[model samples]
Target: MTDLLETLIENREMVQPNHANMLEVAHGGNVMKWMDEVGAMSAMRFSGETCVTAQVNRMDFERPIPVGDTAYITAYVYDAGTSSVKVRLITEREDLRTREREKTTESYFVYVAIDDENRPTTVPKLTVDSETGERLRQDALEGEIDGNSDKS
Candidate 1:
C-alpha cells in the first residue's frame, strides 16, 4: 500500500518571459504542462512504475500568474485502481518574498502505471492515514475548495 501523503509532490517554477503570454502572465498551456508533470511524479511515486496520463479531468483556470511570480504546483494521489492512480493537482501564484499564494489552476489527473512491456501494470493500493491527507482527498473528491488567500 502507498500512503497518500507519501505520494505528495510539491514543485515551483519561476514564470519566465519564455513561459509567459503577451499579457506578461504565464501561459495556460505551460501551467497545464507543469501540473501534468507534477501529477505524473505523484502517480509514479505511488505506483512505483512508469506512469502515463490516461485522462485529465475537469480543469479550471481561475487566475493568472505573473511572469515574475513563482508557479507553485502540488499533487497527491487520492485514490487508485488496479493500474490507475487518481491525482489531485493544484497550482498557485506565489510571491517569493511575502510567501503569499493564490490558487490559479486546479485539476484532477488519472495516470496508468506501465510495465517494461509497455502494458498497464498493477499499482499499490492507496491509504490515507493522516488528517491532512484525508482532508485533501475529501476536497479533491467534493471540489469544495475555492479561490481564497489562504494556501492549503
Candidate 2:
C-alpha cells in the first residue's frame, strides 16, 4: 500500500528568456508540459510502474509567472482505480531571492499504469493514512469543486 503523501513530488524551474512569451511570462504550453511531467512522476510513484497520461482535467491558469521567477510545481496522487491514478498539480510563482510566492495554476491529471507490453496494469491501493495525506485529498477535492463551479 502506498500512502498519498509518499507520492508527493515538488519541482522547480526557472523562467528564462527562452521560456517566456512576448508578455515576458512563462509560456502556458511550457507550464502545462511541466505539470504533466510532475503529474506523471506522482502517478508512477504511487503505482510503482510506468504511467502514461490519460487526461488533463480542468486546468486553470490563475496568473502568470514572470521572467526570472521560478515556477514551483507540486503534485501528489490522491486517488487510484484499478489501473489509473489521479494526481493533483499546483504551480506557484516564486522569487527565490525574496522568497515570495503565489499560486498561479492548478489542475487534476489522470495516468494509467502500464506493463512492459504497454497494457494497463493494476495500481496499488492509495492510502490516506496520515493527517497530511487526508488533508491533501480534501484540498484536491475542494479545488475540483472550485474549478467546476467556474464553468457556470
**lDDT of each residue in 1-152, candidate 1, tens digit only:** 98999999999999999999999999999999999999999999999999999998877888999989999999999889999999888999999999999898888899999999989999998998999989988877776345332335
Lowest-sum lDDT 10-residue window in model 1: 143-152
Q: Candidate 2 lDDT, tens digit per residue, 14-62? A: 9999999999999999999999999999999899999999999988898
RMSD of 1: 2.7
Candidate 1, residue 80: Cα displacement in angstroms equals 0.5
Residue pairs of candidate 2 with colliding backbone atoms:
none
Clashing pairs in 1: none
Q: What TM-score goes with each of the models? A: 0.93, 0.95
lDDT agreement with native, every candidate = 0.90, 0.91
Candidate 2 ranges beyond 4 A from true positions = 146-152
